[model samples]
Target chain A: MTKPLLTVEGLVKRYGEHTVLNGLDLTVREGEVVVIVGPSGCGKSTLLRCINALEPIQSGAVRLEVAPISRESRDLPALRQKVGMVFQSYELFPHLTVLDNVTLAPRKAQKRPRAEAEREALALLERVGLADRARDYPRQLSGGQKQRVAIVRALVMHPQVLLFDEVTAALDPEMVREVLDVLLDLARQGRTMLIVTIEMNFARAVADRVIFLDGGTIVEEAPPEEFFDHPKTPRAQKFLNTFTFDAVKRPHPSSLADPTT
Target chain B: MSIAVLRDYLPLFARSALLTVRLGALGILLAVLVGVLCSAAQYFRLPVLQQLSAVYIELSRNTPLLVQLFFLYYGLPKLGIRTDPAVCGVAGLAFLGGSYMAEAFRSGLEAVDRVQLESALSLGLTNAQAMGSVILPQALSISMPALVANVIFLLKETSVFSAVSLMDLMFTAKDLIGLHYNTVESLTLLVVFYLLILLPISILGSLVERRLRYAGSGT
Candidate 1:
């Protein structure tokens, strides 16, 4: 097995008295793709935010390789560079062109030269099929296109781990496929990604391991096939049942027994 | 109105108008500099500096510019510390305008969505870097209208500079009326000169505002 690229041990996050993540622990090895799914307010997004050090943790530690992720750590900036995150809103810098947005971090934070960063950014933009829109502002693009640009933005950082927080949740129904396709492409390339998503089909297609979380704790985790087809825990079974249309569409036996039909 | 009196004072008005423009520009520039610094202090929540900035904003904003100028020019010499009239004029204007500009800029800074900072941080940018690059530009764009309004306001406030005996446009008009007793011509020239000074700025301010809106919205 490849070495762990990211590790979380006893991760605790709280907003005031209400604990959002209750001592959750997770690990991602090199080039592993982990898909986390849970009901609303289950702390999946908070977990990702804690991992990225966007939110301060209450107790547990998150480490990128060997260095700890925290506000006080001297190497935090360097460590954060290795963990790229894409938000659901597609938070592109509105004042910049697509090309400029892609190049900003490399140039400003990484201190890369303008010419070199632009060269790499242009290539990445081309890879994402956004070469034609390089000079366009973010507002001019469709939701899918903006999400794709966001993915490219994260990718250009050459991060070892990528966190996607419902990257498709805000998209139009038709636009969701385009963003999911991009994620599938990234997974195919063996990029290390921790994605929180609701698209079950895409999750089944792309996830190496599926994790079911509830009430701020992991209920079950297994390979996608086993987890989805045969969820061992009753909570996981109950959660999975919510996603299936059969629960609502099929009539209950009591109703079927009635002769009203 | 006598044409001869109007003709005689035209040159004086022109020179005084130039002085008003120069002083107004200086004061407005100082106001912007102070405003940016104070707003940054408030936004970053620096230890003592933040408290100092808060006090400064309240102190400046609550008092009138006339009172501020009086305190600076007439009140300060009692302590045996003398300030150049020009310096006093600029400082007084900045002291007044800075708080207004700071309020405008602080609102702009506050309006920036929290996600921008998060995205910038996740990309490994430091807090200062995130603020300078990601936050400030958007905030400035949002603050453009308020900032322009503040600028026009500061320029008009320069009318108070004559109270410090600077021979600004108002002083020139008052001096001419005192000497020649041609109140109508002097006051008319005062109105015309102020219009000339303020109209261009208001128009230019709106143009810049529109440009920023287009750039921000891409519409």
Candidate 2:
């Protein structure tokens, strides 16, 4: 069997008295799209942040396949270049144009030349369908457009794994689809992604695997068809019942037991 | 009312004006350099240096400028440190200007968001590089209007130096009034002299404040 592209073992995080990630273990194969679905405040965002070292983990090992030779862990900055993240807030540098924001990290941190980084940024922006908004500042763009620019900014670094932390949480209901479409395109391109989202239809359409998290632990993990159709945990069933489930036609796994007889 | 008297005293007044301008320029320059250094030290939280700068600012700001000038010019001589009256004037102005400048800079530093510094660090910039390239530029822009005000105040405060026996503009006016016993004419010339220097500074300060406000808004 091929080794997984990224592996996390016993990942744990805490904030004073409260533990957020409770020894979560996950592995992603190369080019796989994994979606993490959870209720609000269930450590899904914290898990994604920990993967990129944006939030410090109390204890655990995150190993990437790219650095297979060294068992010794590297620092956060080195790991960050390999795992790019898209935030819910779309934290674009306010002073820079969209093109400059996309190119800043590649040019400054990665030491790529200005011309080369600009070309890559333009191409990525084109991919995200925001080519015309390149010269505009973040404040000038709509919420959807800013999120697309942020995705392109992260993509410019050419990271091996991408982490999406509620990328559509801040968008207007009408604008959410545009941002989701760009992410779907990236997923189709065979990029490894770990997305944390509440968009059930989008997750069901694009994700090969879905992990439902609650109370600081992974409650269920399986292919979307099996997990959504036959949710084994009582918590997962209760959680799914809260959402308007008619958007996706996928049947619940335990639906047969709902007979009126 | 004699033409000979007007011509002779006019030359003296002109000479004293030159000396006044020279002293004011040099004093403001020294103040700017010292103030910037002291402000930076305090802002960066350098331990002993911050305490020293705070003490200096408090002492200079609280005391009267006239007394400070007397202390530097007269008190220093008692301690066997004899310097020229012009040097004493410059030192006193610089000391006073530095105190006000420090507060201006402290507010400027405080106005910058801490996130900008964190973003710089995330981009692999060292602490000093981030401070020099990112923080200081914004801080300096924020401080410019207040700094200009301090410069104008320092220029006007140079009159205090006349008490220490420096033949600056005020001293020249005093000498002419004493000799000719025309206090009204001499004091009127002195007022005009100050307005000439101070009006331009006030105008420049407003212009710079407007520019900085525009730049800040555009960003």
Candidate 3:
């Protein structure tokens, strides 16, 4: 088995007498896509936020592979540069043009030159299908376009791991698929991703593994086939039952997969 | 009524106007410097400096400017500190204006979003660098209108210097009225003189406010 690119051990988070994440543990192998799903306030977002030190945990350890030196310990800003995040709200700098937003951290943080940074920024924007929107401010973009720009903004840092906190949650239904398509493309490109998403269908299609959380605990986790088909725990069965009727009635593309081949 | 009277006193008026302009400029410069430094000290959570700045701001802001001026000009001498009337007047205005300017800057700094600061930190900029590069530019743009308005107020407040025998615009007007027994005309000329100086400052302040608004909206 390959070495895990990222690891979390006994992660615990609380908010003034309320436990949000209760000793959760997980790992992601290099180039793996792991999806986390849960109801609101279930700590999926908190879990992702902790990996990048956006929210410090009470007691846990997150280790990332920093290149060149390959240090195991977490230096948060360095870790953050390696582990990029895409917020649900897009969170683009409203005052900056799209190009500047993408280039800002690279230039200021990484000390990259203007021409080189712009070159990388333009490429990332093009990859997200937003090269033409470079000079435009975020407010000028649609919900889908803004989210895509946000993805590109993170990607421009060349991060080793990407965390998505329901990147499509704020978008309109029609706009959801566009942003998800970008994520699927990134997944196909072999980027390690930890995604907190409500779209179970997308999770079933793309995730190598799925973890379900309830009341700040991991209720179940397994490969997509086993997790969805033969969930062992009662909470997992009940959770899967919510989507089982629709999964049967609708023509899910997974049913068409060549099981024999 | 007499052209000779006008001709005779025109140089003195000009000299006094020069003095008034110098006092206003120096006082405002010092006020802004003190205000920015004190506000920054408060912002960075400096231990003793923050408390001292807060106390200074409160005392200066709450007390009457006249009393503060009297304290500087009259009381300081009793404490064996003898400074020129011009120096005392400028010091008084600077102290008073610094309090108001500090409040203006504090509000401007507060107006910035917390997320912007967080993003700056995430980008590897130090706290001070983030403030200077990302936060302060935006805050200054936000605070420019208030600062400009304060300048006009400071300019007008320079009138208080006349009470300390600084021979500023109002002082000269009083002297001319006392010598010529033309109280009504002298007071009217003083009012016109002030209007001449303050009207331009008011217009300039509005222009700066408009520019900042446009930049904020345009961005």
Q: Go through the candidates in order and give each one's C-alpha lDDT.
A: 0.90, 0.80, 0.81
Error of 1 at A246 (Å): 2.0
Off by over 4 Å in 2: A1-18, A22-29, A51-79, A213-215, A226-229, A245-261, B1-219
The residue-level lDDT of candidate 1 at A255 comes to 85
Candidate 2 chain B: worst-modelled 10 consecutive residues by lDDT = B210-219
Writing each residue's lDDT as its tens digit, candidate 2 over A100-181 gives: 7777677767789999999988888888788898888778888999888878878888888888889999999999999999
Clashing pairs in 3: none
Report fnat in order of the candidates.
Answer: 0.71, 0.06, 0.14
Model 1 clash pairs are: none
TM per candidate, chain B: 0.93, 0.90, 0.91
Write candidate 1's Cα lDDT for B1-219 as tens digits: 888888988999999999999988998898899999999898878899999989999999999999999999988899998998898999999999989998999999998888889999999888888888888888888999999899888888988888889989999998888987889999999999999999999999898877776346421
**Chain A TM-score relative to the true structure, per candidate:** 0.94, 0.89, 0.88
Model 2 residue-pair collision total: 3
Alpha-carbon deviation at B22 in model 2, angstroms: 6.3
Over the stretch A177-254, how does candidate 1's per-residue lDDT look in tens digits? 988988988999999999999988888999989999899988899999999999999998988899888746876789
A1-261 per-residue lDDT for model 3 (tens digits): 667888887888988888999998788999999999877889988887777666757776777753321123334455567778888777676667889888888887778899999998998888888999999977788999989988887888888888898999998999999999999999999999999998888998889999989888889999988887888889888876886576568666777786974
- Candidate 2's TM-score reads 0.72
Candidate that would win on DockQ? 1
lDDT of 3 by residue, B13-81 (tens): 778878888888898999999999888988777999999999999998999778888999899999999
Q: For every candidate structure, what is the RMSD over all alpha carbons to the true structure, in angstroms?
A: 2.6, 6.5, 6.4
* TM-score, per-candidate, Cα-based: 0.93, 0.72, 0.84
Quote the positional error of residue A108 for candidate 1 in Å: 1.8
